[model samples]
Target: MEEALPIRKIIHVDMDAFYASVEQLDNPELRGKAIAVGGSSKRGVVAAASYEARKFGVRSAMSSVLAKKMCPHLIFVKSNFDRYRELSQRIRNIFFEYTDLVEPLSLDEAYLDVTENKKGNPSATLIAQEIRQKIKEKTSLNASAGISTNKFIAKVASDINKPNGQKTVPPEAVLGFLENLEIKKFYGVGKVTKEKMYRHGIFTGKDLKAKPLEYLQEHFGKSGSYYYHVVRGIHNSAVKPTRTRKSLAAERTFSENISSEVYMLERLETIAEEVERRLTKNNVAGKTITLKIKYSDFTLQTRSKTLPFYISSKSLMLDAVKDLLFQEKMKNSVRLLGISLSNLNNEKKEQQPEPEESIDVQLKFDF
Candidate 1:
């Protein structure tokens, strides 16, 4: 067996209800209300929901019909991709100050390897606090972060205290943390896998770890091996910052709206192949894949999922894309379909954005 790498400090930063928060940030009227970013058409799906909306069961990829049913006064706002993109770039700039090994999962989340950062900060936890502080000052937006010895734990930790909070799992606490983590909370274990694991009586990481490797492989196929290793907190994937954070994205705006899920899959297969070619041409691999859809009314939605390991193969990318497609049902005619990948190993950090000036920030991050 290959030996594990020495423990390194990693931080996973994710903005809290990013798009909805952005809507609230720019428009003060919507703060602390049930709001989502997407068209209000009867055949539209929500792209993102505010924390307040989430309390009422509103969620991304959910139909507006259901959202309004859940929250009778639900408010829908149009998405502004250009503004979101600009804000995302600003967030990445803050990350670059700490380390060049910043792997952007999307416009709102990234994994940062801060073992040896530019700030010369000794404590990764402190660095996470500072980054979150800077983000608030620069964008007036809240962020949550996870800090730990590896990417998997760090990513999960960030979610423990969400919406303007931070959580850190020390190296000594990694195993204990994993043992207590619910099986459903494990990264990459979607609904189907969760059900399968439940059938196997694996309700927590502890139970998952109890299964023999061969038994898992027999029952879960190749992914069975994947589950066996994760329960042990053995994920060794690095925080990869590619030469460019701009991923290999292929998009098509249909001449006419497409509402059929079957037709959408056909287009996705073609787009995934194109993304695969782009990754191959760049000589890189991506562990995270995203699917973007635009409704006939011009409102857009994006859904993404990350794998534990990097992939450049066309079929593999297609597999993930297809998984994303079925995760939600279409509520409207789709006018555009796009697929992209990030987490490349060669991404570099050369240009950094300027943070907002004339702002005073207090260092009051909780433990």
Candidate 2:
């Protein structure tokens, strides 16, 4: 038999509690303090909570009222999407410098394929270290990175050490790691799934892997095949880049609702800057600009402009954004403001050229 194929190296990079951490980093007073990003009212949910607040049992998706009850001195601030997006762009630029095969899970997380990287480095562990260092140096932020032979293992490795941590799962160690891992800790195995697994005495990765394929299929349905492969440390997913812009948007909701158009414009300026950076990064022009407004009561409205020609420059894009903003009729005082650009060009071919296709005739067999 022929030799087996070499393993592909993958890395998963995730920022630590991105929004809350950024807020704490910007305002030194908030450091080591319990802080949550959301409303203090009954209707609000916690978008993010600082590490300090987490110590009080506060978490994302929990009610702000409950969070406040847990930590009486909790600081509640509204979401600042503009600032978050700006920081996310800077992080993306850093990822591009290392390898272009980056698949962004969201603004705060991404998977990078570095089997044949530009750094000429043989160790994936070193690449993870370098990327983490660059993110901290450039953004003053902490990121957790996981390096492994594939996405499944790589993603799990990243979370092993969080908050400015990096870890690697070498191919030789994968079996031992998987065998000892708690079943509940496996990706996609949520509380409900874990409960069912517990009822069936499947408490570890080894337990799941030892089960008959048919038994797993009978219980977990189609995902049984997926679990089987993952437990065996075999994943086939490739790092795909299919980011097409159906729309580009920048939005911000304030801590306190205000009716002042002057204050709204100031906020809009920051939002416009973020949109410009994204447009420039994609090298695409937009023909339509939309302005979104959310009133104090949470009612929303929008005014849009479809330009004669596509434009992406900072000044031109901001002008269209301003025009859209000015055209909207104010009702009950705006609490949130946003700007978006759409109708982008998808034909830019400056980055990579088309590869020639070939058809081979011979298939050699060693019998």
Candidate 3:
């Protein structure tokens, strides 16, 4: 039998109703009310709903018109992204106090690996508690944390306690914990995937572990390997820092609308070259390319393609941009053109056989 690796202490921290919480913290009167931060018009959607609003079935992304119908007294507040972003930075500083292995997941959630922490604290649970305390003290907001031997369990644990609490799963209890977990509760297992699992007779972790790897791979494609290992309680993923952006793009605003297809393609080529030069200066290859164009009518559209691999070559990017420009119709006079590339790589993950899904846990936070 293979020896078990030493236990790795992982913590997953997620702010409670992040945007809504920030609003509540900033305006004390908003606390304990059914407040939503988003558009108030029928066409607008709710960006975040306070816990009080949730009681009326109002939720994030729900149309504001419907949200108001759900709760006639629902309060609509405008989004203040600038303030929220500033607060997110303050919370990030709290994570740095323990370990440098902090991975941000948007402006709200993050995964922190404290297996070998700078705080010299051996217990991941204690670290999570301390972090929560610090965040409350610093931001005047509550956050829930989960601590466990691996990222999968830690993430689930954090959700279990919720809103303003912490939970931990010991290494030995992993199997039991998973066996009791619902299929929908599994990270990355969405409604569509859950329905598929039900058809496959996979209702829980134990049910999942019973399947052969080959069977899962045949069905789930790229995500199959993940289900195989996570059901068995194995995860080897590490946190990845948010690195600096490597490319900048500039676009020309045409004075008059030009409807010529060939002209648009040529313009795209020039923009792609500018983006390519910037990538070269920074020594980066972006697998994804985004094409931006604005029409004379002020309507805009952006189309993108991600190569199987990243490249910094100007010719290659220009060629790809040309293909995209030709694929779509030139509905109006081209008023502007732009191009950008992201998904940079110093080392490519796709080059290797995918490390198990659970093993790519930290990378999941980037989503």
Candidate 4:
């Protein structure tokens, strides 16, 4: 008989309304109030919203005007990246006390692998609790966590309890846990994919598992294979310690729409400078330059050019962006403009795959 593979213990930690929470934490009067972190201008979008604001239908990525309409009493605060970064680093430091295998998804969320950790602890559930407690103690902020055998399930489970809580799915329970979960709760199934799954009578994990690999591939293409394996609790992606920076971008939404190409070029010059600064800070150069444009009516368009050689200078990038900008006439007045660089020299050419393991034995733990 083949020996059963060891089940990996992974945890997904996500801070609750991280940006808004930090604002509230710093200003005592803002606590328990509906607050959003971003500009409150006519063209402003919400970067984050507190739970109180969320109750009123205010959400991140929502327009500030709509958010105010949803909650008239909502307060808007500017983003302070320096403070956010400092706090994020402090929280990350706490994670290293237990495990070095950490993958940060953003300023507010990360995945950790602790199968053989520095703590020498056996229960991932307990580890999650301890980490959350430490975060609360150190940052004076609430966090939620999910403990499971893989990153995907852990990420999904972390949302079950919001603000300050955690959930654990042991190896034996993974299959059943996934089987009963709502299709929308699957970590990677976004709005469009959820609607597509719904149309195919796939509203739950069980429904997804019933479809054959061939049928899924026909429907979902490359992503179909991912769905097939993950629903069976077979995600093999590890918590990578270092993640590659795929692209760098800078963009601005104008207070008023501008139709002049001269004005557009001027704005593009500033955006290119910001991109160049970021590239210099990261010590990287890219061959691909993409210009993103959002019209007054909210329709979006992108133009891209890839050079034979990498370039990081603002002047060179501006020249390339100029070509893309004038390559097509403006369909409408522009409300937003952005420039991004990709195909970086710093990106790894190949990635070493994590060893594959299969679980056969039931995990015995009190979660």
For lDDT, the strongest prediction is 4
Candidate 1 lDDT, 1-367, residue by residue in tens:
8553345788999999999999999999999899999977766789999999999999898888889999999999999999999999999999998899999988999999888889888789999999999999999999999998768889889999997999998756666788899999888898889999999999999988899989998999978766777666666667768525557789876767899999998888888888888888888888889999999877889999989999888889888888888888887899999998986776665332122210111112122
Local accuracy by lDDT, each model: 0.84, 0.81, 0.81, 0.92
Tens digit of per-residue lDDT, candidate 2, span 137-246: 99999999998777888888888998789888877777778889999888888888899999888999999989987898899997776787778776767776665566
Which 10-residue window in model 3 sums to the lowest lDDT? Answer: 358-367
Tell me each candidate's TM-score: 0.71, 0.67, 0.73, 0.90
Tell me the spans in candidate 2 whose CA falls farther than 4 Å from its real position: 1-3, 243-367
Residue 339 error, candidate 3, Å: 9.0
Is 2 or 4 the stronger prediction by TM-score?
Answer: 4
For candidate 3, the per-residue lDDT at 363 reads: 27
Once fitted onto the true fold, the runs of candidate 1 whose alpha carbons sit more than 4 angstroms away are 1-5, 243-367
User: What value does the lDDT take at residue 59 in candidate 3?
Assistant: 90
Q: Rank order by lDDT, top first?
A: 4, 1, 3, 2
Model 3 residue 350 CA deviation in Å: 7.3
lDDT, residue 127, model 1: 98
In Å, residue 254's CA in model 2 sits off its true spot by 18
